[model samples]
Every structure is written in structure tokens, then in C-alpha cells.
Target: MTTTQTFGELDHPSRLLMGPGPINVHPRVLRAMSVQLLGQFDPEFTGYMNETMALYRQVFQTQNRWTFLIDGTSRAAIEAALVSVLAPGDDVVVVNAGRFGLLLSEIAQRCDAKVTTVEGEWGKVVDPQAVEDAVKRVRPRLVACVHGDTSTTMAQPIAAIGEICQRYDALLYVDATATIGGMSTPVDAWRADIVTGGLQKCLGGPSGSGPITISDRAAEHINGRKHVEAGIATAGSVAGNGRRIASNYFDLAMIMDYWSDKRLNHHTEAASMLYAARECARVVLEEGLQARFARHAQAGAAVVAGVEAMGLSVYGDKAHKMTNVTAVVIPPGVDGDRVRARMRTDFEIEIGTAFGPLAGKVWRIGAMGVNARKHAVLTTLAALEAVLRGEGYGFTAGAGVDAALGVFS
Candidate 1:
């Protein structure tokens, strides 16, 4: 059996990835990926990993020693968290606000945990009070929610929920895949015991690695179940006769040791991915995290203001939207895909479309990481205005750009 490669048939796009994730990586981070790969155990590589962990700790705003990268994409971290904390038949309550929330519930169920959902509408956020109420009613052992549901580009409020969970003695985890870097998520202050994110989103890096932070409390629980396999356990490492971890590759206790002074080997960590993660966090710091976040916020707001001025309505509650992503309504009669196609083909720009019920009804525009810039914001807005006009949608000319510019001025 063999495989073949062809370049001619591919629809390679230079999209303005104004969607949920896997946004265009920063040039420096991309360059970091090209550096020579050192052995996973190489002193230099391990040093890089150590520093990378430190950088991510700052990025996540946590002092938790368990903060480290999960080798796969964002979901890997989410699964690791869910499976590690959620014992079989443990009561878990998921705050459901959008597609991502539903996905979280589905994942917890796969772990054999008893899962309950606290519901909200597609574009709306899960109210914290509802979560408190659900905790009181269901009394789950764990509470999980997606901080930003990219499908609707909405940021779920977690501060209150975390407190409520703490009061009820339940674990609180956040899948901050889309909102971590570009938005403000002070993990420790938010009382989030566990938080996970992807490098591809706001970090302006590749999608191969994920960063997760666990509080001291979460780490103690995780380490309690640590149960190092016979082959690797030292005298002090957590050991148990408990059944082997459900997923061999994803067990984080071993990963924590690998990253820690224990220096035990886990599957060869991706040196290049680790390099990229380090550089991605570097970019955020060099640019200044607060400044970078503000840029994403500004650019996103610009797009919303710009497009809304062009007569297209923005989807959902406007007050608490995600800073890095936006969901805009596709005007009546304009084919969403057609407009997106035109944006990519002619304007060299791209945006996202909503999922589930909002599918075909919304256009997702992203302003994140390196993409969150004045030029990107202005260009996307102006291009969108022209594309909408070309689609024969009636709107005031230059109103969108002007509206967006006014914010900065």
C-alpha cells in the first residue's frame, strides 16, 4: 500500500481566519518551529520545556506547579482534565451555553461520569446563578464549562461559578481554548481549579500542543490518583494497583513528572511543538499581555462596529462577547457561503460561520493574536462592506469602517 501527494487539486486558501481557532500563527512562532529539534531528553530541550512551563504559568496567570503542555490539540487537555478528576459514576454538572458546552458534557459522559447539564440558549451565556442553582440541585462532584464557545463567540462567566463550586466542594474546570491568550482569564483570580487552552487560537502558534494549568488543590487530587506504572515508579512517585489509566498517552501525572525534576520519560514530547509554545508565549509577553489582549478586544470591536454599521446585525448578547471572536448575522437573502467564498477568492480574507442552530445564519469573524491589528481590522471591515454591497445587500456606504474607526479615535 502507498500514498501519493498532489498540490494542484488542493484549495489552499490565504484566508483571513476570523473564525474560532487555528488562527494564523505569528511569524516568530512559526520560525521557532523550524529550529533544530533536540532530543526530548536533551538538556537544551528540557531547559526550553522548563522555561516554556514558566512562560505559560504567567500566560495562564497561575502559580500552579502542575501547569504544563498536553502533546495533542486543545481537546487532549480537556479530556485529560475530565478523565483525571471525574471518577467513574462521579456526579458532574456541565454548564451548557453553546456547541462547545454540549461537547464538554458529551466528553464527561464518555468518562463514565454521571453528567447533568445547566442549559442556556445557543447565543446566550450560561448564567452563573443557574450553575449555583444546578450545583445545589445536582450536587455534582465536578463542574465544567467552555470559557468561550467559539461557535457563538461568547465568553461564559466563570468567577461566580468557581466560587459556588468551591463552596459546594466541587472541582471547576475551564476549557479556555479560544479565549485564553487574547482575552483576560486570570486563572487564579477566577478561582478556576483547572484550565486548558490551545496554542493555535490566541497564542499565534501551531495546533499540535495544549497548555493546561491545575491549582494546588486540583494537583493534590490528581497526584493522589497518580499511580505510576510499575516500570517508571520511584520510591516517592504515586503508585496504586488501580486499573491502568484509561488513556495511556494522556495521563498527566506522569507528564508532570516528566516536566518536573523527576525527569522520567513520557512518550517523546514534541520538541518543535514545545519550542513553538515557548515562542508563542514569548510573543505575548514581548507584545505585553495586557496590550495584546486590548488589541484583540479593539480589533474585534472594530469588526463588530464596522459590519454592524453596514446593516448586518451582530448575533447574541453584545455586552459580554469574546474579545477575539465575533458572530455576525448574514443579512437576509445573501448566501453565507457565497459571501465567504467571495471574501476568500477576491479579497483574500476569511471569516467563520456559526454551528448548529445558528448555522447558515451567522458569520464568525475573528480578531486574534497577530491577526488582531488595526490594518487587519480595517481591511476586513472594508472588504466585508464591499462584499456585502456586491451581494446587493443594502447598507450605508463606509458606515462600517467609520463606525469602527470612531472607537479608536
Candidate 2:
């Protein structure tokens, strides 16, 4: 029997989200999102939009003029970059090392690109030589990869790969969704033609906005495929002679026109998410990118030290591991989900469970954005130690917290 029950004013439990993503939002970003809404085409709103673009330029460390926000999550930006630049039957080489890497290949295939993949071990970054060899042999039009795949907690080295793409005259697109504000991603220095990221990870905001930057080389290709919708098409609108992009919402050229002085109406802008993204960038820049990176690095190291001191093994090549997330191997005979549940129920904390081949074998703990701090790291470690002990996992008492504090001290 169902009975109508009116829901009361919204309230929720407070939890420490020490997981792969969708972590706690920054208080400043939350406040920014609560500001009064503005008309999409209002001068003040457009001014905020322009400020967002300029702010992300500093965030992405690029001077590219086409830098802007996509009114969607990280994957939307990925699709936009690929679908706009890759026409039917174009060759693309994707490096598939982790879950996010596989996602790159999946999205590329849906775009009708003849996708070839270069595989790497799950716990390791892709080898630049392998990518170079594949590009040399395949002569691909595009090279796509993830900067950091949280699934495996591995951060790929992309500078040399970018140089290889340049030598072969191929466009390089990177999903920096996991690494963007937590670490350094110098788009121009890395030679990435297109780079996309989300606000949820290290940006300390909600997941609705995707910040992206494109070099002139990549922009030219996307602009070539620009086609205005018939409903809004003007006499001045140039009918794109190229193949129409497969997805309307994910089209970059039209999005650029909407963001430009043309002020062409596309989809109504996601106003609140834009404000959140703006403030996320503002907070990050105010802290200084390098300092933010260092803080995350220290927090990540604390996680590693504490986990190891507690007799758990840290997964992946430490040298290439992301500075915001750490993967710890689940101890023998310990039920991963059961331990995670105790952590949640008793400690009000959440750590990540792994995916793909890594499932059942490891737990991922994220220290990024608003949660990347000494207290957050130590709190998670303390909770994890207690949970592990309850799960019949033996460890030296106080070792984890002690080691973690050592790092901060």
C-alpha cells in the first residue's frame, strides 16, 4: 500500500567523502551557486561568462582563445572535442590503460572513427614509445588519452606523447578530468591540442560544468565542421560544407558561437553551474596553482604513508600516481564492501571501491579539492584503521595515524 507523504525541507547527513570523485563541495563554491539567477543573455551574465573563460585560461595554463565551459560533466566535454574534430572514418589512436582510457576508445568509436588502441598494464602509465610507434604505423588523425584514470590511480606522462603527435601532425586530446586542479596540466607546454576537465574532482564544485581549452590547430578542425541549426540560422551563417557533427548538444563550434560576441542562442546556459565553476577557479587561483598542487601532493603522500604503515600495499607505480587519489590493496580475507559499510555507518566517511579488473582487489581514497587537507586525510586514515580492525584485519595500533601525522609534521 502506498500513501502520499509530503517531503519536508531538504536536509542530509554530513559525510567525509574520501573517494574517487564527487567529493564535498567547497563552501565558497556552494555560496557562489546560491547567488540569484540572471538571464542567459543579460550583460552581467555574459560578463560572468567572459570572466569564466579568462579564469580557466589560468587554470589550464593556456593562452588559447577558444577556452570555455561546456554546460555538462567531464564526459560531455570529451564527446564534444572528439565529435567536433573527428569526421566519419578518421583514424584515431587511443591509449587504453584504465577505465577512463577505455572510455576514450568507446566515445571515439561512437564518433565513427576507426579507433586503434595501445594497451598498458592496469597499474602503470602508457609508454610514450608505444604511443609513438602506434601513431607512426597508424598515421592517425587524432591521439586521445586520459591524464589520470582514477580507476587505476595512474597518471599518464603526456609531454613526450604530445611531441610525437606533433611530429606526426596529429591532434592530441587529453581528459584531464582527474588531474586538472590537483596537479599541473600545462596545456601549451604539454603540446596538447585539446584538453578537457570537470569541476567535481579537484575543482571543488558540482559536476555540471566541464572546462575545456583548444589550441588553434584543434579549433580550426572543429570550426571547419561548424553548422548552425536551421531554426536559428541567419543569412550571415555559413552553411558548413563539412560533415555535420553527430551530436547536437556536444557540438563545439556552435557552442563557441554561443559564447562569442555573436551571442547566438544555443541551449540555455546552466547559470548556477557556471557561477560554481567561476568560483572554483577563483579559489584555486587565489591559492596559486603550484601551492594547490603541493597541498594535494602532501595529502596524497600522507594517505600512502598511512596506508602502508597500516600494513596495506599501495597500488600502481608511485612515480606516476596521481597526487589526489590513492589505491590501497584490500587485505586478505577482508570483505571490501563490509569494511566500507562500517566506515560509512560508524565513521560517516566514504572511500571508493574499484572498478573493472581492480574491483574486489582495492579501495581508492581521494584527497582532492575541498577535502584535500591534513585533517581530512587523518580522519579517513583513523576511520579506515578502525574499520580494518573490526573486519579481522590486523595492524599495529596507531601506526596509520602516526605515519600520516609524520608527513604533516
TM-score for all predictions?
Answer: 0.94, 0.96
Give lDDT: candidate 2, residue 277: 96
Q: Which candidate wins on TM-score?
A: 2
| Candidate 2 Cα misplacement greater than 4 A, ranges | 1-5, 229-242
- Writing each residue's lDDT as its tens digit, candidate 1 over 326-386 gives 8888878999999988888988887887779998998888888888887778888888888
lDDT of each: 0.85, 0.92
Q: Number of backbone collisions per candidate, in order?
A: 3, 0
Score residue 105 of candidate 1 by CA lDDT.
89
